[model samples]
Target chain A: MRTLLFLLQKEFLQIFRDKNLLRQILMAPIIQLMILPWAANYEVKNISLAIVDHDHSTYSQKLESKIFSSGYFKLADYCASFNDGYKLIEGDKADIVMEIPANFEKNLVRENKQKIFLAVNAINGVKALVGTGYLGNILNDYNGELRLQWVQPSKISPIPSIEITSMNWFNPGLNYKIFMVPGILVFLVTMLGSMMCALNIVREKEIGTIEQINVTPIKKHHFILGKLIPFWVIGIFVFTIGLTISRFVYGIIPVGSIGVLYVFLSIYMLAVLGLGLLISTYSDTQQQAMSLSFFFIMIFNLLSGLYTSVDSMPGWAQIITDLNPLRYFIEVMRMVVLKGSGFHDIQHQLIFVIIFAIVFNGWAILNYRKTT
Target chain B: MVAVQLNNLSKKYDKGKIVAVDSISFSVDKGELFGLIGPDGAGKTSIFRMLTTLLLPDGGSAVVDGYDAVKDYKAIRGRVGYMPGKFSLYQDLTVEENLNFFATVFGTTIRENYELVKDIYVQIEPFKTRRAGKLSGGMKQKLALCCALIHKPSVLFLDEPTTGVDAVSRKEFWEMLKRLKQQGITILVSTPYMDEATICDRIALIQSGKILSIDTPDAIVRSYEGSLFAIKSEGMYKLLNDLRSYENTLSCFAFGEYHHIAFRDKMKNYSEELLKYLENKGHKEVEMMPVIPTIEDCFIKLLKN
Candidate 1:
């Protein structure tokens, strides 16, 4: 116990003494927490649009007003030719083009149908997909209105149209920020815990301090615990600061109890720090550790259900996420914060994280040899 | 009693292509200050690492403080202090903090072992608040020594502690080591500087991962077999070329400001004959005289054989 205390004291002193590292530990999460939520939004709005109206009829003008008033699009230009609308897209002035046929209103009234052309710049697939969906809804509403004007009340059957109502259970506003902030918080703590722990050990190797420590009477388990505990403390500290910023700055108040969040966070840090130490044991230099940590963090971030739904992933990829601690933590964060989920809701994930911690930390200690 | 005993200890690298420490045997008495003198890559650090239990020997077995270096590592770890080849102390820590940390880890306190490090700690006492990294090279050396001695182990390993230190600090470090010796600690120190060998009670001259000779410094110097003459003259470069070609010169190697030459035959008046020959080779203001061999001279002689 005394040996562990001394080692912990030394580690904390070293961490706080380096001003640059201290700033990075405290400042990076704050900055990223504040900025990433706003920029990483998936809601597409203010899409630039160009129109080639061959039919200067009342219906075409009405369609133009409808597109602009929906607040989903900004009209870039009104062109006489498809070529002009295409130029608007090429110049980056517009994201999509609508070309109305010459007899759109005539066909609608006489033939009971009309055709229109749409060209979407698919470079950014998400923006294009969302914009098209919004436009389709508007056109459907217009079609309904036309159907009502042409049909007489007496001719209409004595039947009612089906009505469907949707109420988003947790986030009624469907705000993407609320969903993303928790995941980003998960990433912040993971990067801080894993990268910092990895570099810490490898730095000792570089400076030749590991040899000095190895010659002491301290056990491998004691040393591993000593190295991990300090970073685990810092991880919780960073996590708290992030939670506070999410609460005050972004209004990401958790629906669940704060104590529950911390209970999960503490164990999650253990798992991440253990993996960091494992990388440190395998690498000989700080550079190698940094690269190896980056390699793992990159894969974890991509597959952690951070940006996309895990349900859409292939079967094998979903199976791989079972081994990823970030997946469990992110699920836990979103569950408790957004869904007011209790411990029972996240019991399976909690068990996985605990098991991950034991296996990783145990492997790291076993691989660390007092004699090399 | 033997403080450290190695029986045919060996280590190899790259699947035995490079032998770092060949099968060699040596031992140090309980209170002896022993020196392993060799240049870089002589496996001094490797041997220290093995004895300190930071590395495993590929062959043979060694015991430190009556504990096997491999199986009894935990026992040996508590009894040994190691200062690695590099300055391994935490650079961000203050001098006092580092000492306190090492003491506490060893299950002791600074007050318990104050006497062991007091002589060296006082010199850098004013800089106790300064970070170890910011200290001068000499001050860093003293701080490392203090930390290594803070626990008062039975045996201490010092690996090239004075490699990059200035002359004044190097001398001060040796003085501190002597004070440490008075405490009756068995010290195994390694250095590439041959001059420091005399300070050790016994010196082992090593080259290429093998021990060439082991004896007291005085005995090693006395073991020089033949006469060695220090010769210098105007146009020294040309003089060196002419002397190596001389018919009777057995060995000629540059030693700082002069060339040390040995004759094939131990005949009388060789110094004069060498000077006459240099003069005949158009040398001017030539000088020659016999000088006593130093440890380096003995090392060169041993290496030749």
Candidate 2:
């Protein structure tokens, strides 16, 4: 225990002595948390639209006005020819184009039918898909209005329609920040915890200080714990700062008990720090450790359900997420923060994280030897 | 009692492709100052590492302070202090903090064993607050030594501690080692400098993972088989080539300002004959004389045989 205290003291002294590292540790995460959630927003908006009206008829003008008033699109150009509207899309100035036929009003009035063409830029597939869906809904609404005007009131038959009233239970306003802030805070904490722990041990190897430590009477587990605890404390500190920022800067507060969140967080940090120690044991230099940690963190970030829902992934990929600690972290963050879940709800995730802590730390302690 | 013992200990790298330390055996008695003298890549560091329990031996067994190096490594770790070839102290730490850390790690306070490192620590105590990375090469070496000694281990291993230090500092370091020896600490040190070999009570001259010879410095020098001569001419480079071409030259190597050469056959007045031959080859200032062989000369002669 005395050895561990000395080791922890030395580690903390070194950490606090390097002013630049201290700044990076405290500042980088805050800056990333403050900015990344906004940039990572997936909501598509401001779709530029171009329209061509060869008909010059009252009904065509009405359709154009209805599409513009829907507020999901902005008019980029109003052209007299279809070819001119095509030119706008080809020049990348418009995301979608709508062209009306010359006899649109005559067909709708006499034959009760008309044909309209939409040319959508498919380069950005998501924008094109959502924009076309919005325009389709508006055209359908306009068609219903036209049918009502043409037909007289008969009061002989009844029409049936279905409406969807979606109540987003956790986030009523559907605010992206509320959903994203907690997940991003988890990611920031994981990155800081894993990278710093890995780099700290590998730095000792690079500078040859580990050799001195190995020749002493210090137990392998004690040294591993000494390395783990300081960064664990730092991870908690960074997480708290991130939470304060989320509460004030983004107006986010956990609906559940903060104490439950910390219980999971403490276990989560042990797993991550243990992973970092394992990487350091296999690597002889800091460069190798950073690259190895980066490879794992990248996989964790992509598959953690931070940006995409895990259910939507392919079957094989979902199985892989079971091995990802970040997946559990993000899930629990959303559950506790948005769903107001208690410890009983996140208990399964807590078990996996505990197993990870035990497996990784046990393997690290076994691999670290005083005599090789 | 044996402080350190090796019996055909060996180590290899890259799946047994590169042999680092061959089958070698030696021992250091309690309270003795033992040196492993050789140039770089001579396996001095490898031997030190294996004995210090930092590396595993491939073939045989090693015992330190009466504990098996392979099986009882934990007991040996508590009884040994190792200063690796490279400066291994934490550079980001202040000198005093580093010392205190090592002391606490060994479960002792500096106050408990202050006398063990006092002589060496006092020299660095004034700069206790300075970060170790900011210190000079000599100061860094001193700090490493002090940290190694803070635990007062029965056996101390110093691997090339004075390799990059200045001349004055190196002299002072040897003096400190002498003082440590008087305190009855069994010290095992390695050095590439031949002059430093004389300071050891006994040394094993190693090369290519093999021990060439092991004896007292005086015994090794007195054991040289043939007459050795230090010869120089006006043009040292040309003189070296000319001396090598001489039919009787057994071994010729540049040693500082002159060349130390040995002949295959012992003969009287060979210096006169050699000098006369050099003058005939258009050499102006030819000088040759018989001299006693130093440890380096003995090492080279042993390597040649």
Candidate 3:
């Protein structure tokens, strides 16, 4: 235990002395909490729209007013012909265009059946689909009002409706920052911890100091542990700062107990540091270590669902994420912060993190060398 | 008592394609400074690594401090200190922090063992707070040595410890090793520097994964049997070629300001004959005389044999 503490002290001293390492640990979480929330939004507003009204009637004017009042679309331009509307879209000034038929009101009055044309940019296929649906719903409401005015109220029977009261469980507002800050913190910690430690060992090999250590009476496990503890502490320290930023800046308060989060984070940090040690053992050169670490971080971040919901991914992708510890960490963070989940709710994830820490750390110790 | 013993030790890298350390046997007695002198890729480092328990030999049984290097690696680790060819101390840590860290890892305190490394440690002790990466080459070398010696091991393995160090530091380092030797510790040091070979109590000249000769430095130089001469003229290159073409010259190679020539037999009045021949061959200010061979000359002769 004395040896372990000594090693731990050395690691801490090494970590605190390097300013670049400190910066990397703190930078990611700060940006995620302060800036990311403002940029990521699911509800699209202020959409540019163009209208081609050949009829030039009161009905077309009223339809435009309704579209503008919904606040989803802004009137970019008005065109007398379909070509002018196409030009507006081609010029990138409009996202959607609506064209009313010639004599639109006369046709509606003389013959109850009339048609209007709607065109949307399909380059962003998902956005286009949602925008078209929103516009269709608004027009349907307008049609229903016209039907009520024209038909007898007693003759039209009321249609049954099912109301959906969606309570976004963890984050009521579905703030992307609240969802992302914890995961980004995971990424930064893993990248910094693994890269720094990997380089630390390999750098010794390159610089000839590894010989000095190898010649010593130091045990292999002690050497590896001494290297890992400092980075692990740094990882947790950065995580705490990220949590503080999430609460103060983004107003994201964790629903789960802070103590429970720290316990889980502590285990997760070990798993990350273990991974770093494993990389260092396999690599003899700093360049090889850095490149290999970059590869792992890229794959881990992508598969961990740092940017998207894992539930939305395919079943196969979800299974792959099961092996990724960061995925479990993100899930636990969201459940604890957003849903106020207790130990029972996050017990499985916590266990997985513990197992991961043990396996990775064990592998590192097994591969590390006391000499050469 | 033997500090290190190896019987039929062999290590091959890349699935038997590259034989780094062939089947060889040697042992280092307690309190002796043994040197493994070889050029790069001569398997010196591989042997050092195997004895230090960093690598497992394919076919060998070795004991380090009475512990089997393979079966009892932890015990070997606890008894031996290894300084690899590369400078590998924690560059981010201060000199004192690195020293303390290694001491702590070995379950010892710097104060407890300060007396052992005090000579080398004190030189860099003023820079205890300075980061190791910023230290000069010589200072880093000293710091590395201090870290390695903090635990006072029964045996020490230094793999080319002075490979890139300055001449002055290299000299000072060997002197420190001599002091450590006085403490009755076994030391196994490897170096390509021929001059360093003279400092070891016993030296093994290795090449291409095989030991060519093992003896004292003076003995190896003494066994160089050919009559050698150092020849110089206005055109040293022309002089070398001209000497090689001579009827009695067995071998001619350039060495610094003179061309070292070895003749087939000892002939009385050979210098006068050689100088007269060189002058007639259009050479200016020709000078030739018999001289003693250095370790480099002996190594070249061994390679030829």
Candidate 4:
């Protein structure tokens, strides 16, 4: 225990004494936590639109007013012809185009049938589909207004549509920040625990101090634990800061127990530190350690269901995400924060994380050599 | 009792393809100042590493302070102080912090064993708060030695501790070692500097992972049998070439400003004859005189033999 304490003290002294490392550890997470949530949102808004009104009638004008008032589409250009509208879209000035047919009001009044063309850019397929759906709803409402004046009272009021209501749990307004803040917390913890630990060990190897430690009387388990515990503490500290910011600044409160979140985070932090030690054992230089950590972070964040919902992904992709510990953490965060889930709701995920932590830590300690 | 004893120990890397340390045996008696003298890659570091229990031998067995290096590593680690070749002290921490760390590792305090490192630690004491990274080469060397001695181990293993150090620091370090030796600590030091070998009580010359010779420094030097001479002239380069052409020249090598040469037979009077030949080759002020052999001369002779 004394040997372990000495090693831990040495590690802390090294970390605190290096100004560059201290700055990176403290500044990176804060900056990422503050900036990333604002930029990473899947909800699209303010789609630019072009209108080609050939009808010159009150009906076409009404249609234009209704589309603009929806607040989802912006009138970017008023083109005189279809070719002009095409140019607007080709030049990237517009994401959608609406063309009103000539004699649209006359045809609707005389024959009760008029056609309008809507062309949407399909490059960003989701945005295009959403805009087209919004336009279709407005057209349907316009048709209903015309039919109410033409038909009898009984025909218009015979059947009433059943309205389906949705109330988002925990986050009633569906604020994207509420969903993103927890993911950012997970990212910060993982980066701090794994990358920093790996770099610490590799730095010792490069400086040749590993040989000095090997010659000492300290046991391998004690030395490894001493090195791991400091980083683990720092990771938890960073996680707490992120959680505080999420609650106060973003107005996101955990529906589940905060104590449970911390418990899961502690286990997850150990897994990350173990991964870092594994990388350190394989890498001989700091550059290699940094690159390997970067690779894992990139892949883990992409497949962790942090940005997109797992249910929306393809089946094979969803299956692959099962193996990512970050995916499990993200799910647990969502459950505890948004769904008000208890231990029973997250038991399976917690068990998987525990097993992952044990396996990675075991592999790391087994591969680590006391002598070279 | 022997402080360290190895019996036919061998270590090979890459599955016996690269022999780092061949089957060799040596021992250091308690309180003896022993040296493993060899050039780089001559297995000096390998031997020191094995003795310190930082490496396991492929074949044979060894004991350090009555404990086997393989099976009794934990006990061996507590009883020995090691300073590796590459100045492996923690550079991010201050000199005092590094000293305190190593002392704490061995379950001791610097105050408890202040006398052991006092001589060397006092030199860098003024810069106790400065980071080890910022220290000069000589200061770093002193700090490393101080850290290694903080626990007051029974034996010290220093692998080329003075390789890149200046002459003054090297001399100062050797003096500190002598002081430590007086305290009854067995010292096992390795160096490529032949001059430093003279300071050791016994020296082992190693080459190609094998011990070529092991004896007292003076005895090794005395064993170099030949009438060695230093010859220099105006055309020193051509003089060496022409002198080697002489039939009586048995061995010739350039040794600091003169050519050291020996004859095939003792009865051959080759010095004057060689000077005449050099002078005939338009060499000016050709001079030759017999001199005794230094460790370097003996090393070269040993390599040849």
Candidates in order have lDDT scores of: 0.91, 0.91, 0.82, 0.88
Docking class of 4: medium
What are the models' TM-scores? Answer: 0.97, 0.97, 0.91, 0.95
Residue lDDT tens for model 2, B1-305: 98899999999999999898999999999999999999899988989899988999999999899999888889988989999989989888899988989989999888999998988889989999999998999999999998999889999999999999999999999999999999999999999999999999999999999999999999999989879999888899999999999988889999999999999886644777788788888888787888999999999888888
Stretches of candidate 4 exceeding 4 Å from the true structure: A149-152, A155-164, B241-251, B263-267
Residues B1-305, candidate 1, lDDT per residue (tens digit)?
99999999999988999999999899999989999999899999889989998888999999999999999999998988888878988889999998888898899999999988988999999999998899988888888888888899999999999999999889888988887888899999999999999999999999989999999999988888888889888787998899889999877888899988877776655776777777778899888889898898888877777
Model 3 lDDT per residue over A1-372, tens place = 776676577666766776886766677657665676566555677778899998988877888888889988898899878888888889888889899999999999889978999989888776788788889978977877777688765654675444456788666677667777766666766677778878877876777666656655556676777777777777777788887887787777787798888888888888888888889889889999999989888878888877777889999988988988888888887778777888899999999988988998898888875643
Q: Go through the candidates in order and give the C-alpha RMSD of each one to the true structure.
A: 1.6, 1.6, 3.0, 2.1
DockQ of model 3 vs. true complex: 0.57
Q: Write the per-residue lDDT of candidate 4 for residues A183-302, one digit (tens) a residue.
A: 888977887788999999898889889889988888889988988999999988888888888988888889889988989989988888999999999899999999999999898888
- Provide i-RMS per model in Å: 0.8, 0.9, 2.9, 1.1
DockQ of each: 0.87, 0.88, 0.57, 0.79
Q: Model 4: which residue pairs collide?
A: none
lDDT of 1 at B147: 85
> How many pairs of residues collide in each model?
0, 0, 14, 0
- In model 3, which regions exceed 4 Å deviation? A152-211, A303-306, A363-372, B266-273
Candidate 4 lDDT tens digits, B33-89: 999998899999888899888888999999999999999998999989999989888
What are the runs in model 1 whose C-alpha is more than 4 Å off?
A155-163, B266-269
Fnat for model 2?
Answer: 0.97
Q: Of the pair 2 and 4, which is ahead by TM-score?
A: 2
True contacts kept of each: 0.90, 0.97, 0.81, 0.90
Better structure of 1 and 3 per lDDT: 1
- Interface RMSD, Å, model 1: 0.8
